[model samples]
Target: MSLLEVRGVTKEFVTRGEGAMARKSVFTAVDKVSFEVALGETLSIVGESGSGKSTTARIAARLLDPIGGSVVFDGQDVTRARGKDLARFRNNVQVVFQDPFSSLNPRYTVERIVTAPLTYQGITPKGGRQAYAQELMERVGLNPDHCRRYPAQFSGGQAQRIGIARALAVNPKLVICDEAVSALDVSIQAQVLELLMRLQRESGFSYVFIAHDLAVVRQISQRVAVMNRGRIVELGTRDQVFGAPRDEYTKTLLAAVPRINPEWDAKRRQKEAT
Candidate 1:
């Protein structure tokens, strides 16, 4: 039994007609997606844009109601949960959005941003909100003194750290990172990845790491699911999928990794070594 299980989940959106000629049609966003994330393990969904990876993530996190299938989190069916149940489900399964700037409120201070989830969940820690928020800030690589500053005051990476702190405020078991570090520079991306790895180790949290970058997903995921055109075409351990992908699409993606520093000697050496 995994901590999270998505069984045959499907989502479809009816694209409305526009103007006089635009016709109405249903767009299948996710199709029969089934997978599981064990406690303390990361499951990466890798795909290009418009691949329905984000849609699957949203369905799994209960942000969107699926048209079919089930999302069982910690043995509770989240697809049908409502009211207090929905709130609790949200607390347990938090999300860190791709854009750090847009995720945090520009007007609210960092401390307030982190503490908002706690108040929403009705959790008042023994040391109170201030102490708890400070602890969370430090945990996410932010200084407690900067808690008074607004989102605009921080760098892109720092704003993301604030987002991470906010996600952890409720002691969530699962974190759905929808392209979490994709918007940052290379150096900041590495730093944020390291921080996420550390958080998972300390909190025993599972991550649904969704990204188009195979390299990024490879760095953190234990298991990988390759999605295409609203369907999961391949699913396996990281080594299995990345090293010996059975699907032609997966192999094509692997083959497309850019080689900016191409060299005959290096190419030969790499091939021979492999």
Candidate 2:
């Protein structure tokens, strides 16, 4: 069975008109979107901004409730799970936000920041929460000794590492990376991607990777879903979608990527052949 199933999920937002003269209107942000993420797989949702990819991620994480459709996790319906059930669901699923700087609390030390999930879930680690936090920091490539340092003390890449550590603190089955590497430098992005892939290999956790970057998506995703205007226009394996895109929007998105120089491409091809 799939680890996570989002069947015909939909979300809407209601906006009030400016002042008393304004009227209220409803806007559908996600329309009957459906996808599945298997255990230990990376399922990426790629789309331009405002395409509802983030909204879909939120719903999958159960951070937001969908007005329509159902979310099933490990064979349990979680669209309306409550109390202990909801809490357990949260522990099983975690999210790493796009902006690492804003996602972390500036006031808390790295130890506290990473251990917050454990604290909220009322879980005490085998040795100690701080010890577990340090272990996670090390696992994510951050210095375990720096656990006492605050968010302001780290660079963008380090801060993102902290966020990843936090998301993995509870040993979640699924991790929703909502543009988790977008804010870092290209080199840092590569490092973070490597770290995530390594962790996944070691931990066997699934990932719902949401991003607009097709190149990045191709790097980490086993399957890809392309969203446009609040719906998935194309869904397939990375090779199938990138090699032979069926949707026009998907083709346009692929074409939008900066083309490599002929000299560089030729060199790359020659190197591969050799």
Candidate 3:
């Protein structure tokens, strides 16, 4: 079953020109975009910068209210959910932002940060917040004892793990990762991606992964959506999109992805073996 569905969603921003009497114009960030994320599936939206992938992520998370279209989560319309309804929607869906440090509160200890979602939901964990937070820390491969430390004490990858732990605190049905590992080093990105896949296998929660890197999208997504100029140019399964692209934009994007020289890689591997 589809866990989250976004239909004909449109978002626009009104901007004014340089002078006081300058005219105002509307810039559409997202235009009639639609997609579905199935239960226990990873659906990635891939595009270059300013392609509205992040905007679509925010819309799916309900951080932005679209001027048009509807957002349905687990069969309930949540485009305009307010108060308790919104809170309930938040509990089921969590977001892991692009930057870990910026998303976390520096002043707060790791424990507080991880458990903040529960606190907001007014749902006290059975074993108390500290125990729950520590459990989450350990689950995400972080040291449970370091729960008392601040965000500044952790490395970039570690901090992102803390963010992941926070997202899992609510036992969300879907997790929206908005360029979640793009800021990390390539090796660290691989580690984080592995962790995410492992967690999904264990928890059976879906993922709406938004990224610009086609390589990263290939690793995690079962399905792919290519967006350009605020619209989805192509949507298909991983193999269909990567192996036989139908859209010109999609083909261009695929061609742009950097690939290592196979012959050079083989020679290096042989040398290492000797």
Q: Which ten residues in a row have the lowest lDDT in candidate 3?
A: 264-273
Per residue, candidate 3 scores C-alpha lDDT tens digits across 49-164 of 99999999999999999999999999999999999999999999999999999999999999999999998999999989999999999999999999999999999999999999
Query: Candidate 1 residues 1-274, lDDT tens each?
Result: 7899999999999997879899899999999999999999999999999999999999998889998999999988888999999998999999999999998989898889999998898888888878888899899989988888899999999999999999999999999999999999989998999999889988899999999998788778889999999999999998899779999999999999754343853574475457
lDDT tens digits by residue: candidate 2, 1-274: 9999999999999999889899999989999999999999999999999999999999999989999999999999999999999999999999999999899999999999999999999999999977898899889988999999999999999999999999999999999999999988999999999999989989999999999988789778899999998999999998799889999999999999986466965674475457
The RMSD (Cα, Å) of candidate 1 is: 4.2
Which pairs of residues have clashing backbones in candidate 2? none
Model 1 stretches with alpha carbons more than 4 Å out? 259-274
Residue pairs in clash, model 1: none
lDDT score, candidate 3, position 174: 98
Q: If both were scored by TM-score, which would come out higher, candidate 1 or candidate 3?
A: 3
Candidate 3 ranges with C-alpha deviation above 4 Å: 260-274
Sorting all predicted structures by TM-score, with the top scorer first, yields 3, 2, 1
